[model samples]
Target chain A: MADKVLMKGNQAIAEAAVQANCEFYAGYPITPQNEIPEYMSKRMYDLGRVFIQSESELAAINMVFGASAAGARAMTSSSSPGISLKQEGISYIAAAELPCVIVNMVRGGPGLGNISGAQSDYFQSTRGGGHGDYRLIVLAPSSVQEAYDLTMNAFDLADIYRNPVMILGDGYLGQMIEPLELKEYKKPANLPAKDWALTGCKGRKPHVVKTLYLIPPELLIKHNIHLQEKYGRIKKEFCLYEEAETKDAELIIVAYGIAARVCKGAVLKARKEGIKVGLLRPITLWPFPEKIISDLADKAKRFLVVEMSMGQMVDDVRLAVNGKKPVEFFGNAGGWMPSSDMILDKIKELKL
Target chain B: MAAIGTAEIVHAVNRGENLTFIFVNNAVYGMTGGQMAPTTMLGQKTTTTPYGRETKEAGYPLRVSEMLATLDGACYIERCAVNNAANVIKTKKAIKKAFQNQIDKKGFSIVEVLSQCPTNWGVTPIKSNEYIEKEMMKIFPLGVLKDKGN
Candidate 1:
């Protein structure tokens, strides 16, 4: 077994990315996520890899777009407000069908609220955070270990699906240190090369990889449907989640990221008190573990979704439950982290 | 080959090294329906600037070559108008120098070419060439704005 070293979530993500041989990284410095680019600056330069401290979030994502199209595993990282600026280039990355990884170590915000972890970006990360009809493989990491593991998975998933993959971590997760095994994971055998890359052709016809479908409505329609089909394949193959006491629990606490960790402790405490409370931690927030919740709703009495936002994922839980079970939400915003005690209080209040 | 956003070029060069840039400045947004560009001439009338770009409302034309020349990282920066054969020869030389600087690992180099947009300018090809000589040069002077080591 590989020995584990204590590491921050942000630094773990950077280490995992380099281990995965993602040779290009372009990013601007932002709060709570600065360690990512800072770590990359050193490691990438030591190995003679391409690393550009891009002008802004806009330039950073575009540089990622250029590098990914040029057949390099490339990425960028930012926090909440910065990610808003990246939405345009992210949309272009999707429209061009370029594979890359993006990380958002989220902070509290409608706009630059504070430099602390918050899960309000759930809607933005899971929903189409950019213009145009597209989807990102949004992976939410609950701890430093998952941060490292998912960062590697994100690269493979992006290349396998020919789509962007986002590793959504919060500020608390980025700053906290935990023991993580830096293992050399194997690449999936079925993953292939980027044959559609914009590498210059020497003996063959020059290839053009662009998103401009000006004429012929059917052409754009075909492209849109093709992307949807790819997303469908991803949904079928990559619906990931973790379960605890879901089989016989009366109330299942739905959460993800750090929010889920707090919920887990509360679930344990509630179970010791003879209450049948458990957790459903979603690993992939996009291909959202819908069937599991739907199936659990058939047997569970209720759901209590605790989050760090004003009740966003509660909507998804409600949709999954679909009136079969009562759904309730308790959240804290603007960097006010919810504690296990708060979640346990909510559990006691639910009395399911 | 087309003109890019000003910030995109300026910041990329300002932050990076060993890069080459060829900036095509036609004094207008040429292909995108003749709108105003950051390099649009002071009094030029375009689709957006119908009132000839009032100074109080719209700022003066941005001299991107001169602007980027101030940075220490910019190893070379030159502007040349290709309106005639003599200027075309000079533009070619400037273009070669910029690429050579990158090959020599001489930091960032940019060559801004003063091009003519005949259709967008609403003039004949000959008149458009003359326009660069008569109008564009007054605002955007043709010279080596900066060279770290001439």
Candidate 2:
């Protein structure tokens, strides 16, 4: 094991992205997530990699689009409002089926709400955050270590699927500091070469990366059907989550990201008081751990979902439980965070 | 050229990115059925402007080359026309120069070409060429607006 070093979560993500061999980075400044682009600017330059403090979030994502099309592992980072601006380009990238990583250190928002940790972007991120039927593999990291590890793995997953991957963090997760063991990034075995990338054709036929399929009306339909099949495979193969003390528990609290950390603390307090409570922390927000939750539904008496938004993930939780068990929710939005005591109080109210 | 992506033009120039932008100015929204565009000339008739375009309703024509020329990061900026064979050759040369500037890492280079759009302009193709030489050239002059590389 390597020696542990203390670092901020945002810096951990940036450094891990560098270790993942991200060749290009472009971003516009936004609060809570600015440290990522700031660190990437200096590090990428020193390493003689391409870095651009793009004109806007739109430009930044478009730059990522261009680099990914040209067979470079590219990345971009932003917050809520900035992420909204990149949606158009994100849709284009998804339609083109290019591989890249996008980081969203979420802050409060209906619009520029405030710069504080919030999980309000869950619906936006998991549901494709753009004008398309495509999906991004979204990873939610609760701790600095997980932030580092997941960011590194995100690149491999992107390349393997030839799709976009999103590292979904919050303001607290981005700014929080913790000791993390910096693991050396080893490339995963057998990632397919980006043969479809638009490098200029010398002898081989030219490859075109475009979204318009207007020749036959069914052309777009066929493309969309292919995309849906890819998504179905990802859903079947990749679903990551952590189960803590759930065996023979009466209440299982489902949570992710910063909210999950709080739930963990609450679950500990409940256990100390002789309450049979457990925690289910989802790491992958999309292709969400639906099967485990559905299986847990058989044993657990009820499930409580905690979040920093007004009950977004709870919908998925309900779908998974499917009336087999009672599913409940507790959440806040637009810059308010949940505490352990508040979550514990909510747990007690359930009378488990 | 459309008014969209104008912010990026200035942003890329300011960053001194080694990129080439070929701006085509046809004076109307050709694909969308002859609507008013930012570069639409004064008194030009389009779908949006049923009568002659008035200054109160629309604004003066935007000279993109002249606007970008003032930026210090711009290594080259030129406006040319492809109305005639000789002018077409000049436009090609301008485009080639812009790409060469990018290759030399000279910074942002742009070549704005005044093109003909007979469908949107409601004129014959020959009349469209004449329109570029006569009316469009008056607003968008043919020359190098900025050329630090030169």
Candidate 3:
């Protein structure tokens, strides 16, 4: 039987990564997400996993990138500001198509915004936050259990896609505690023959994985096109979302991560008030649930988008709605969280 | 020691090794109270050239990523601004890419992060970011210069 345990979202993610056989963890401590590295430092050391408190977020991410490229399951976690210090490495991993898991316990931002919860990074997480024509499989976990499950699955998806996977949550989710079930652990298969990885070439012909194409512009274009195809395939196959009361909902609430949790409460309140509101929570943020939103547009008359940031995800929702329904945005920036009553007021004001 | 030139970059790429180069472009020797660096922007005021960096006197801010991207071995090269929130996000992406490039064993990667030296710039952290945005980004626009395998 699966054992139930109460754990903070950050701790659950750390444990889940360990159970997934992640042997390498490199990161700098940052607010809300500090518990993750703090827990991993003690646990991974005992487990003989390589855990390093890096000099900076830059060094930590690079270390994890190096280990992961060597076919090791590796991970790193940081807050919004620290995560900003890591985009260079993230873009490189995306370009090289290496498998690694990165967690961003987002905080308020737009400088040193605040140490509070905010989803302002929605655009950065889903829309190739890093440079180049690359994409990360961004997963948004709404609960502690989901945080654990999504982190475990993030490694698998990174391997499956041969790309970096981002577990994007906010300070709320990172700091919150909830009941969780420790899932059975399994080791990743011997990394599929990756000739590109750097493992001191001994027997095999030396392999080089690089983004530099000193070749003709034509060649670079071809490489970019190839990456686009891969992204298209991912969009087709990896769009994960949950629909709550969407079937009979006249008003669909689209939210993600911690915002989704708040939306749930709002939905419940709205239901009691006789408002037919539903919830569309995105589990996979990158290959966003555009199709579901589009489908919902056909059935629902209104869509309300909520987030901790100042209307970042609202643009995506508008694109999905395509003017079929009125898509309204309700948000607070700089770590401010919307209460259930506040969201309910928005729903009432919108008359959705 | 490896000579600092194009040859070093080429050699690293041919061998498929990861290298990180942190280029501090303060336009002037910031530690020495704002003297000009090789990457100092033209017409910019530095302690060394308080009259403002004249085109003839200070030359131009070396667009490091642009030159580095020309190398075959460089996998990821980007210029980032570290002074503010919007720029901070861009800078973090650049940093992550540089590290990821090294780990992926995809040749050499470099991040030229524009940082503020309040003491040298004769300003506060707030004004430093403003100076970077208003003055620095004009010369070194933030973006990825080279992305081959990514």
Candidate 4:
């Protein structure tokens, strides 16, 4: 095993990004996710990388856009409300097909609800939080170690697709402390070169990175078609999830991020009590492991979708199940998290 | 280019980023049919402000360069007009200086060019230039508001 270091979730994500050779970072200070920018400011400064504590969330996302266009790996992060402010820029980055990482350490929301961890941004992250027909490769990490690992991989995923990748976390995941192995950084093999990046037109024609496609309505439609094709390829090639004892279980719990961690414990208790319950945790929220859930729906008698938000991921679960079996929901919101006993009680109530 | 992003301007100035902002102030919205913009002159009439912009109703015109000049991080801020040949030359010089400041790694620089929107202002192009020289200049004075390098 590599040398293990105890670290907070946010700091691990920051350190992982730095290790991934992320050269530019710009962000505004928002609760729950503030440690990411705070850590990046110091680490990036020492490494002589560009780090701007930008004036606003809007400015931060735009700065990330400029840096990414200049062929540097750039990143920005914010909490729920701040992420809302960044949607317009995110849409532009998506339309331009610029690769960048955006971490949304989701807090309780609707509007400045609280600074605690919550999974309410699931729909927003998966359904293209911005205004457009686009999607972000959303990765949800359930633990501090997964947070570090996923954040490290997020940069490569962003580059691979020429699309923005989102690290969707809740406040608890952002603030949690756990032991993490500091793995050696290895650049993935045969990653595509950024030929589209704007590195100044020296001995070549200029490359214009813009989202605007005016004149001739077909031009915009053509661009949209290209984006949709890329998304289809991603959906087919990359769909990740974790399954635990799902083979013979009659009841399954579908969850992700912190909610999945709690359900893991509940699943164990249900098993100990001689009840057949299992867990399916989706790691990639956008390229959501729908096929696996659909396949499991045939075997399992029923499923329970749990989240820290008020029934957001449940919609995705229901869509994946598609009436093959009954899908129930267990959720809490506004900084409250479900306990294992609470989930066990729900399982018993379902008479599984 | 437009005053709709005033918050972004404030943010950039505060960070002292080595960037140039070319602010083209046409006083009124040109697209989606003319409407009053932040830089619209007091008592100016537009599609939205058909009764002429009243101080009580519309507030004062935003002097963006002056507002940004107050930030310590702003290295240079100048407002110019391209209404005539001599002023056009001056506007070009100011723009070059702003870019030069960026190359020299001097912090935030902005050059506000008070322009004319003839179509939106309901006037001929030549008449719009005259309005910029005769009326617009009275509210948005053309000169260097701040120059930290000098």
Off by over 4 Å in 4: B1-150
lDDT of 1 by residue, A231-336 (tens): 8988888889999988899999999999999899999998899999879999999999999999999888988888899988888889888999889889979897
TM-score of chain A of 2: 0.99
DockQ each candidate and list the results: 0.02, 0.02, 0.02, 0.02
Clashes of each: 0, 0, 32, 1
Candidate 3 lDDT by residue in tens digits, A118-171: 999988888777788888899999999999999988988888778899999989
Worst 10 residues of 2 chain A by lDDT: A50-59
In terms of docking quality, model 3 is incorrect
TM-score for each of the candidates: 0.72, 0.72, 0.70, 0.72
Error of 2 at A159 (Å): 0.3
| Pairs with backbone N, CA or C atoms under 3 Å apart (clashes), candidate 4 | A117-A171
Q: What interface RMSD does every candidate have? A: 16.8, 17.7, 18.3, 17.4
How does model 2 score by TM-score? Answer: 0.72
Write the residue-wise lDDT of candidate 3 on B60-142 in tens digits: 56565686677676777777777778877876777777787777777677777888888867788888778888888888887
Model 2: docking quality category: incorrect
- What 10-residue stretch in candidate 4 chain A is worst by lDDT? A48-57
* Per-residue lDDT of model 1, residues B1-150, tens digit only: 222356666677777578989888987666435655667787777654554654553467878888888887788999998999999999999999999998888889889999998887789999999999998998889999888845
Error of 4 at A28 (Å): 0.6
Q: Better model by TM-score, 1 or 3?
A: 1
